[model samples]
Target: MIQIKDLHKSYKMGSNSLHVLKGINFNVEEGELVSIMGSSGSGKSTLLNILGMLDEADEGSYTLDGVPIKNLNERVAAKYRNKFLGFIFQSFNLINYKSALDNVALPLYYQKMPRKERMDRAFHYLEKVGLAEWSHHLPSELSGGQKQRVAIARALASDPKVLLADEPTGALDSKTSHEVMELIQGINDEGKTILIVTHEPDIAQMTKRIVNLKDGIIIDDHKVEQIRASQYV
Candidate 1:
């Protein structure tokens, strides 16, 4: 449900210009899970920021759900982002003093929903992520996995159409990372479009398809089902 054409981003260093993404083109469809894999400096995170409206490409055509987004006013873009997109970062990004339930309900404040309703939805997702009893616990009181659960619950509180995660499992232990991936997989199964940027092959494998990028261009795209089936004989 998203499209990008001729996307380019550049930056100026002290004495040289660094072109990160060059003429990139791709589409992410509804109900599909995609992973963008690359080594450091490959622009995977840059691509995700642009897609999330957190940054703008120097030149490109980006249309989300059939509307041109390149020139949307700041307020308009923010509104659309709040309505249609959810983000999970490598860092938990939780308010240290806030309880899990309050953190999840934060985005709903932007929607102007009643407090009770937001809390209800937040509780539902927090529980869905196996954090029901931890709702009243602050971030410091939770483990890394539990904190990530709060972050995921916050993202879902918006009922966003697309979820973009950047190195979602980067900071967690291997076992915790696996648990988080399963939670993300469950959301994708429910038809939410998901695009994740991860350097780990195991993390990329969890998605339906993996797109490898290098030097700001896409190099390989693989369908997980095809890869797995071919291995079976």
Candidate 2:
């Protein structure tokens, strides 16, 4: 679960300040799959960064699970981030030289999990994402969808509370994109809270709820009948 109220963010450009998020407010319940939809410069990325605790808001409040996320020291923030958030980026963010299994195992390694358990968990998640057979492949050896699946497995390997995805399907072809969305939808069905930041209407529709952002504020927020990505895949 997540909550935000009256959130505001801005960046200084020399003498001028560019406002990115103004009076943003929203909550995501446990197990809900939600998409934040916006055009470029509409503040979706700023909102996602704040939600992921990768950046701080200039004003307002953000509470993840039950802890206040404000004014925390970097060490504490990193701890909370590792304990609660899993991130997926459009670029996949895999190390070029790491095999898929090693990439998925990296987060657990950072957590200091035992090597045996880390590899077991990594292989489990890779299997969950239908990438077990590709475990030895590097990012360069896999298709875009396979790479994204590896990324998804890496994100899940840590067993975080929420998955924060930025433009998850942006870099793939339509069929591959839908395939990835289908995988995401399956994850959400198992009660993982997911917040996806995407501009694509069709991508947003795959989630249960859509929050439309414009001019740095939420313009519309509503739940809709979910569209199954498997249909398109």
Clashing pairs in 2: none
Cα deviation in Å at residue 57, candidate 2? 0.7
lDDT value for model 2: 0.95
RMSD of each: 3.2, 0.7
lDDT of each: 0.89, 0.95
Q: Which pairs clash inside model 1?
A: none
Model 1, residue 69: distance off in Å is 1.2
- Per-residue accuracy of model 2 over 148-206 as CA lDDT, tens digit each: 99999999999999999999999999999999999999999999999999989999999
Model 1 lDDT at residue 164: 89
Q: Model 2: what TM-score?
A: 0.98
